[model samples]
Structure formats: C-alpha cells, structure tokens
Target: MVLDPSRYQDHRTWKMTPGLLRARQPYFRNNMIGLAILAGVTAGIYSYTYRFLHKDNDFADVPIPPIDEKELEQLKKEYEQHKNERQ
Candidate 1:
C-alpha cells in the first residue's frame, strides 16, 4: 500500500534527538550503536548455533576424523601381529 507522504511528513521538523527518526514518524532511529550491537549479537548467536548444529554434516569432506582413528590403527597392528605369527 502506498502511503501519502504529505499526510505523515513535512520538511519543517522539530527534532528532540538527533538521528532519532524521520520527520513525523513515531519510530525512532536513535541509539544506532545499540541497534548495531543488537544486530551483531543476533547474527553471532545465529551463526554459532547454526554452525554447531550443522558443521559436521555440512562439511563431510573435512579431514578431521569424527571418531577415534586409533581403532583402525589397532586393527592394523593386530593384523600385522597375526601375519607375523603365521609367517
């Protein structure tokens, strides 16, 4: 819906706080620093949560073994022992 700008706004504005809001708008844009901080915090939280939930699944090719690689090495050692015993 298109709003009539003339009904809500005027060039002559009496601002109580600088950078607080557009002329005639009730919403305030004051404390831009706080808004930025909140946005950054939200984004950081979301990113952290999303990564924690999905990192391993998404990065299937990641070289880091998800489980103990020692199991494989133990199996190999066992096989080698058995082969040596046989020979």
Candidate 2:
C-alpha cells in the first residue's frame, strides 16, 4: 500500500536551530559524560592488566657470558687483514 506523503511531512519539517540546540544541551552533556566514563574505565582496565602480566619479569640476574679477549683479537685482526686486501 502506498503511504501518503503528507503524513510524513512533519518529520522533515524539523530544523536544527539555536533554541533547539539549547533545549537538547543537557542530553548532549550527559552522553559526553557517559562516553568519557566508559573510555576511562577501559583504559584503567588495560593498564591494570598490563602491569599485572609483566610484574614478575626481572632481567637483572640474567648472566651474560664473558667474551674471550683472544678470540675477539683474532677476529679483529682477520677483519683488518680482509679490509686491507679489499682496498
């Protein structure tokens, strides 16, 4: 069935005016406050989870193997000889 255009004409007649905006100010403010609260809660949860997951990680005691000075010197000498040959 075809709907009468005249019946829906009232829906299109509404225009955004300063007075209308002023009337809806409280609604917009409430929505913004709610969105901010949700974002803050999400960030707080993520921060807490990240800290909790990484709290036990300690790398200070990890022993680094000592480098042999003789082996390093030999490698350096070989590299210098190769460089001199290339030039």
Candidate with top lDDT is 2
Give Cα-based local distance difference scores for all models.
0.69, 0.80
Model 2 off-target regions past 4 Å? 1-15, 49-58, 74-87
Clashing pairs in 2: none
TM-score of each: 0.33, 0.44
Can you write out model 2's per-residue Cα lDDT over 1-87, one digit (the tens) per residue? Answer: 464334324445544555666778889988999999999999999999999988876876899788899988998999999999999
Off by over 4 Å in 1: 1-8, 11-30, 57-87
Q: Model 1 over residues 5-53: C-alpha lDDT tens digits?
A: 3433443653244433444255344566679999999999999999898
Instruction: Report each candidate's C-alpha RMSD, comma-separated, in the order given.
Output: 14.1, 7.9
